[model samples]
Target chain A: MTTGEPGACVLGVDSGGSGLRAALVVPRELRRPDPVRSPEPVRTGPRGIDAAHFMAQLLPMARGLLEKAGGGHITAVAVGAAGLATLGDDLRAELPSALAKALGVRRTALAADAVTAYAGALGDRPGAVVAAGTGMIAIGTDLTAWHRADGWGHLLGDCGGGAWIGRAGLEAAMRAHDGRRGGSRALLARAEAVFGPPAGLPGQLYPRTDRPAVLASFAPDVAACAADDPVADGILRAAARHIAEAAAAVCPSTETSADTSADTCEVAFTGGLFRLGEPLLAPLREEVAAQLPHARPVPAAGDPLDGALHIAAEIAAGRLRLPLDSRMLSVHGEGVTS
Target chain B: MTTGEPGACVLGVDSGGSGLRAALVVPRELRRPDPVRSPEPVRTGPRGIDAAHFMAQLLPMARGLLEKAGGGHITAVAVGAAGLATLGDDLRAELPSALAKALGVRRTALAADAVTAYAGALGDRPGAVVAAGTGMIAIGTDLTAWHRADGWGHLLGDCGGGAWIGRAGLEAAMRAHDGRRGGSRALLARAEAVFGPPAGLPGQLYPRTDRPAVLASFAPDVAACAADDPVADGILRAAARHIAEAAAAVCPSTETSADTSADTCEVAFTGGLFRLGEPLLAPLREEVAAQLPHARPVPAAGDPLDGALHIAAEIAAGRLRLPLDSRMLSVHGEGVTS
Candidate 1:
């Protein structure tokens, strides 16, 4: 059901390095804001972005979202982003203002992708949400606040993410080169085919700079390699452990307590990485269960976009709150927190 | 490094699924044989068996020559093996009647891991040797044969080594149970904490098996997933191309051709799968050149046993022969002509 005319149309945006996405949430009770009813996703170049540049890309998308809403009166906008976003009055303001200006909202609430995702899934409740995309971040919410662990990215960390698996696959290739390991030749050849001559590998690393998708594209190769190849299997296993670790780290801050085995909020996962399904999720679920014996795992109802829309609805109703509890409101969508 | 009386030395035997290998060669040489003084390698495996497994393992300790020297003249023994060498074959049929009976010999030939290694590194000659340790094979020759290229195993393919990289890795983890495209959290958790459970994962997978190490043990991970992680950088770049392909597909009758380019056998590499070398010797060397261009990638001296020894003296005598063209031979290793 639409928030009704002059209906409070709220915009939700998820900005990533590759592109910026904006959705017009009209408060649907069944499923997410309709994809067909929504505006076509706007495409934008990833480079040359710092504040102003970020705004330029987002504003147009915001306008598109508005246009696609069939001229409804927009009340407010909420943005969930890949980078850090903390809202406060002092210096080192964490809330993402770059997106705020584009949305034309002075009071744009902000949260890290992890927190927003948890908000989207659990609705500001005490639960854990794992964002398994090109990168990985696990967010957990308790009664008062939220907590996180393991969002280090491809290089420093990011155990069970698309990027980590892809990078690991490439490393296996190099190990093969040095004669220290073994694997299928097809994997490396594919890497070379995609990245370019192995000789000039270093120079080719940053051709696109801000684009994580370039590297994320290799995740399938890692999954494929892991299926039959021991080396690839190891990489996937490591990624699972990393993601599980993040989930575990946040469990303490969730409804689960160290004193008792019962968890306050069940765990949930979102994004493409989780879509890898059994190979990754089964092990990950097992690992998480082993670590937090009392914690229960629930499949994510929808993606970050879906979560974003829920948050927009909450904001529109002035019911927006942090670390939502199940009692706060009803969730209506596929894979919503139980 | 002689261990006993001249006529009472232990034999070194290297039996592979491929063939039978025996050497009156002493066990001391199996650990650290004096290459300069080692005897030439011999081959007497069954029809299906060839130098691949038999030669790869035993030749290192100079088994062939000692066999020709006779086992009655030897004492204690050391041995290496492959496949069911540990269980399958009935000793009565697999071994020669005389040797199996041990009528006159104090000890029969032992496992020829050294010899097997030598075959890959030194082939029939003598010199430096290395290996990727998987189905991928890479042999090179200076005076003897040195080997490299994803060795023939599993499928008729090579890009890098590490059987698990493509087929084996995926199979081990069962492709993370994603129905052709996914990841396994359990497998990933097990692999990440190969040494022990990292701070985050639960201990469930640990109970199932020593999965972490088992999965990590595969080489393909190094090649496929290490691009972003320094731990796997060189590993991903490793593995060079093979000089030949099996067309006729007959036992030993397979016609082989080398992709001899501007860089012929003048520079090459040999191993199970090179750590940082992959796809082709050309691109691998080129990658190496990214750091040290002029550095010649001379083929491995031999498979490490008497491979180089077998050919070193022959080359010195200007009569060392190769089944493939000299240029192709230079690129790969001295081939065993039927």
Candidate 2:
């Protein structure tokens, strides 16, 4: 509690379908008004680490980060994992202790990646955050309640995510091959450049073990072709509309809201899809505005790593107030209510 | 070649994602006005049999059927298999000889399931056939040209198929769980009845080896709830529209066609989705009419097995005028030009 005293450090991990990243930082560094520039992570790799082996996969990454921070006293360790939503309440409750023990930290926090993303984007404020990477979900809080929409996964949902865009691109490529409308020649060329002949697509797609990543890899091509390709542009617009709908779905209805602040909900966007910049953000903002006229577009104050570190700092000071169902555990594996 | 010979027999096989069926019949019996009543198949099992192992799986079934037919001189063996479209021309060409050797037949024919479905539905007449089972595709022949649309697979296409409906139902279930709109209480209840709890859906869906089958199992519930459930009704209507679109996409345009038959293209619907009957068919007819006014809905004249037998008979009589690329082979493995 000495406000980032020497050797007082915290570890934050953001693990998703696309990649795993862990950052170690002093708590005081997160107090700035602007977004915290995340320290270079000690370990990073392509994601889709199985939920069953999440703790096992994460422990080493946390350990590596702690080691890199030079034998410091870890105040807290926080993990925001993509598949965390699938874990039941009991499993979620058990995770804090497991993470505490694995990281050799006095305190630990675990949450769905969307929760951390919301916190990272809006901090302690009440608003909505739409995170679209390999998958997509929208999480929002109206101070009293939390709402979530979509992020179901590639097969069932994740409609506006990077993987979804990539899939749409691939479908357009195939349609072009069949001389169907709604396909772009540029998109087909881009796909052929990456995966060779379009005929080889099934070989590359069907039998591959890491299908999410393979599909998501096509997203960049979709973004790159958005300037001139109608198919790619259409895919992007549809994705933006979906993301906007997701945000509107999670945000409290303005008509029924008793809170005066609810008239204008702050909405923030994050994730790899946004890296396409205005090609994504412009349509996203427009659609969000169209759907929720009172939606005020705000740049995400930070990324999930920053959110994790902020939670870690708050947990260390016993000041964390999360609307999410979260538990903290001490090094001795005893639950600590925040 | 013999006509109505005592020993003249043809084997017809219909292999789809759900099951495989084989029947042996004399060619003369198939020339009846009514559809041939296929004899009980000797082998049946779940589909998704690999292309590489297609012969391995089919041989036993064909042999069993041949034995059941009681030592008749096998004239031809024709197979309509799911996933056949994904196989290359060379592999498809090779299938004729492979089947001929395995069945001790003089002629063999191999086609995508939709092709046989079309042949079965209209009996070589100029028209389109929309097949929506575990997957969906439309194959149409104007007698001079062949057209195909959709049936890309569960991931990229198959928009109106059982898998698609099942996926939509699951999404609605998840939406209901998240307290979002567009979820039917009945749909959720039906889903929980089969899969236990909604919370376990992602676990059941993501890691499963037979995802398509699992997804398809939900289609019946969607059909059952169509009358009372808005979500179910919407799903069914959308499916019908997609199926209609696919049919229209594959049919020849009336304006440009030199043949007057193009002005009134006959459209036949087949597969498990149609088993829902009017709840599925009514909207399908409406959508087809909306998309292609000249489209005429026709009851299927026969099943895929009958279509295979028809082809076999034609091959034996040297009267088959198939628009498709087909090859015949004798037991000695020499390619016999059609």
Interface RMSD of 1: 13.2
Per-residue lDDT of candidate 1, residues B103-171 (tens digit): 233222222233345444434332223344444433333333333333323222333445424333333
Per-model TM-score of chain A alone? 0.75, 0.80
Q: lDDT for every model?
A: 0.46, 0.71
The window of 10 residues in a row where model 1 chain B has the poorest summed lDDT is B245-254
Candidate 2 segments whose C-alpha is farther than 4 A from its true place: A1-6, A17-20, A27-71, A87-104, A143-145, A176-200, A225-231, A252-264, A324-335, B1-6, B27-70, B88-103, B179-186, B229-231, B253-263, B326-335
lDDT of 1 by residue, A159-255 (tens): 5688767766665564454343344465667677777654344334433453345567777876765666777667777777777767766764433
Per-residue error at B160 for model 1, in Å?
19
Q: Write the per-residue lDDT of candidate 2 for residues B1-338, one digit (tens) a residue.
A: 24346777776777664466667775445443222222332232232334335566666666665566566677776777655655434445466666666556777777677777887788767888888788888877766667787777777677789999999898887777766556678888888899888767777888888898889889988999989988899999999887877787777666654466555888888776789777788898789889878888889888887777666766666566557553211111234544
Docking category of candidate 2: acceptable
RMSD of model 1 against the true structure: 19.4
List the lowest-lDDT window of 10 residues for candidate 2 chain A.
Answer: A35-44
